[model samples]
Target: MSNKPLTYLAFIILVLGGGLLIGANTMPGDWYQSLAKPAFNPPNWVFAPVWSILYVLIGVVGARTWLAFRRSMAMRLWFAQLVLNFAWSPLFFGLRDPMSAMIVILGLLVSIIGFIAASWRQDRTAALLFLPYLAWIAFASALNAAILVLN
Candidate 1:
């Protein structure tokens, strides 16, 4: 457990978390508040904390995978998913298009699954770390679909 890898991990985590924070800061504002939400919609306050946890988990998984496998396909998929994750907020909130956001989420879900599958052989811990992320994204996909339908 060298401090070097840990340092890299911390840097990766901060970068990923920063992206999430930037997205979160771009509040949907009145446009989002006026939308017809589904019955299951979580309160607006729920997103920040949940996403914060998920981003940290994602960063951990990324660090582990990178430490173990460098720029492997699993790492690539992880990066791909992160990019898609970053894209969702702007599309859904900034652009105010739930439909397009749903599309991005779908891609994110696929990338996440791919990352998990690829990471499973390389590092089970890393793969396992993604499970909660997968679950959350699944829930998010459903939420996006519901918003598209309701709005």
Candidate 2:
């Protein structure tokens, strides 16, 4: 394998993280507190640390997958899911539309499944990397659905 620097991976993380922070900021105080949360709603503090790690994983796997394939269809799906993942922040936090956000999360979930399939078809590790992300989003989607139903 070539020894190309993984600088772009860090850049990807930075881009996703920056957008997440900005989106999270758009929510005013008590934004989460007032929501019709579920029994499994993670503690407020859990979000930042968890998301930080997840974002880094995302970037690394994405970079690895991209590097492995010069121009594969899976590579394109990887990006499509990334965009959808990034879009969730604004739809949920920035707009404060739980219902709309739920819908976005559904799309995000579907795209993630597609992305993982693409990742798995080419690179197993890349697919493995997204497992935690997929699990988390699945739980989050459940929470979103619950919130929408109760609220």
Candidate 3:
């Protein structure tokens, strides 16, 4: 009776469920609506679906890292990025501080890149799984920077 499936399930729930819970609690609301957005700003409706998909990928990658590299730098970066990821919405929307959110997002971006690099040789599949996440975060970091400049 391998517990691997249960481990995968738990990791998926942790990442996806936690992200959704945090997102629900930190809805942008009227405050974000008031901000001067960049021309590239995505419609509000695009966020949920994108994040839902990304979170699932993130969860799977996270589980793979956990199972193979629990004591490695990839695992540490995974945790670091998750904390930063979970903090971004609250700092940005809930506290209405784009500056802090930008900082957090930058940290998240760095941690994500570090995770990819760390896991590349050790767990190439895990590293590969993070590519879309990397691209999205890069776009998001740009968006965060644009909002900071615009507003």
Candidate 4:
């Protein structure tokens, strides 16, 4: 095992932060509570726990890729998805614009899919971890679209 402590720590932080960044916009007293959500929208309590778990998985998948392929395309795609993931928080919750958030989420969805595909090429386990995230985002995108149209 490599004793690259700092590198490992950085990867851990990246994964956790990347995961947190996804639901950064969905908190109470933010745009989320203000909006008239679809009846199908999940209860607010469901988000945090789900996202926290996903964050851990995101970190694991990233670590797996780094372990398996080091500095390869998987790493690049991972970074791409992370950047895209970070952007969603400000767009949705911070700005409180469902339309804008929708666009950002759609773009993020694409990047995540790309990340999944790229990660899949190197590590199937890592790619599988991203699947739930992708599906959740898809569901979120639909909810966002509904809010945009309804509001």
Candidate 5:
């Protein structure tokens, strides 16, 4: 097998598997259930499918960026966002600190935008792939803010 396929596979597994592990460990439990939520808060069932798709898209973008521009700003932003992405769940669900989670998510959103802007000239497809994830996270950021206000 060529290095390209292996790189894609490795990144997909890294992103998707890491997301699954973090999600499984940081599942919303009674603490989350007890907290007040915004009216627009999505149902529990909605998160899995949305995140699953986003993770794949993220993985693909990461792989493409790694292959084409390993040391570029886009790659750095990708790593930065992944760290923030992985941290949000634990901070919000495991530690049950919406305030800290909110901070991390804002940084995540910025890093995502940075990635898109950095990738736009070099790889439009990779940049486009991130649009849905951006929209979802933007919604999630609003939802997070609403939850903080409500509760």
Candidate 6:
């Protein structure tokens, strides 16, 4: 077994994680601070670390799926969810539109489910890797909806 593929996976994971970190830099700033959040809203400091870990996990799953089944629907769904993931920050923070952000996140949730289902047959590990992401996004979607309602 050559290590070449593992190296490539690591490289891909790094790139994807970096991209997510960059995208996450679109912060909420004063606008977010002023909003009426739910009682369960986590402290501001919690988001960075949580999202960072989630992104890394997502990257690992994406790399695994790609390695297991390149150009397959599983990979496509993975990519699609990633695109939606990247879109949320801009829609919510940059544009300051929680309603639109909620829509995007809902789409992301769907895409993630699709990715997990597609990956299950090909690679159970990859499918399992997405569970945390799905849970987080579900939480985020609820948060987005709550923010939309509160503000």
Candidate 3 Cα lDDT to native: 0.93
lDDT of the candidates, in the order given: 0.84, 0.76, 0.93, 0.76, 0.95, 0.83
Comparing candidate 3 with candidate 5, which one achieves the higher lDDT?
5
What are the models' TM-scores? 0.90, 0.86, 0.98, 0.83, 0.98, 0.89
For residue 48, model 4's alpha carbon misses the true position, in angstroms, by 0.6
Per-residue lDDT of candidate 3, residues 1-151 (tens digit): 9878988899899999999999999999998898898888999999999999999999999888888779998999999999999999999988999999999999999999999999999989999999999999999999999989998
lDDT of 6 at 141: 88
Lowest summed lDDT over 10 consecutive residues: which window, candidate 1? 11-20
Residue by residue across 1-151, what tens digits does model 6's lDDT show?
Answer: 8765785568456746666665658767899899999988988888877887787778777777766687899989988887888888888999898888888999999999999898888899988988988999998888898888888
Model 5 TM: 0.98
Q: Which pairs clash inside model 3?
A: none
Per-candidate alpha-carbon RMSD to the true structure: 1.9, 2.3, 0.7, 2.6, 0.7, 2.1
What is the per-residue lDDT of model 2 for residues 1-151, given as tens digits with 9 covering 90 to 100?
Answer: 5544555556466656665776566653577577777788787788777878778788777777667774877677767777777777677777778888888888878877887887686788888988998999899899889988878
Model 2 poorest 10 in a row by lDDT = 2-11
lDDT of 4 by residue, 66-145 (tens): 77787888777777777767777677776776677788888878877887888776688888989998898899889889
Q: For residues 7-117, write the lDDT of model 1, one tens digit per residue.
A: 667846675667767676778799988988888889878987888778777877777777778779998898899789888888988888888999999999999999989
In model 4, residue pairs whose N, Cα or C atoms come closer than 3 Å (at least 3 residues apart or on different chains), thus clashing, are: none
Select the stronger candidate by lDDT from 1 and 6.
Answer: 1
RMSD of 5: 0.7
Which parts of model 3 are misplaced by more than 4 Å?
Answer: none
Query: How many steric clashes between backbone atoms does each model show?
Result: 0, 0, 0, 0, 0, 0
Error of 5 at 61 (Å): 0.4
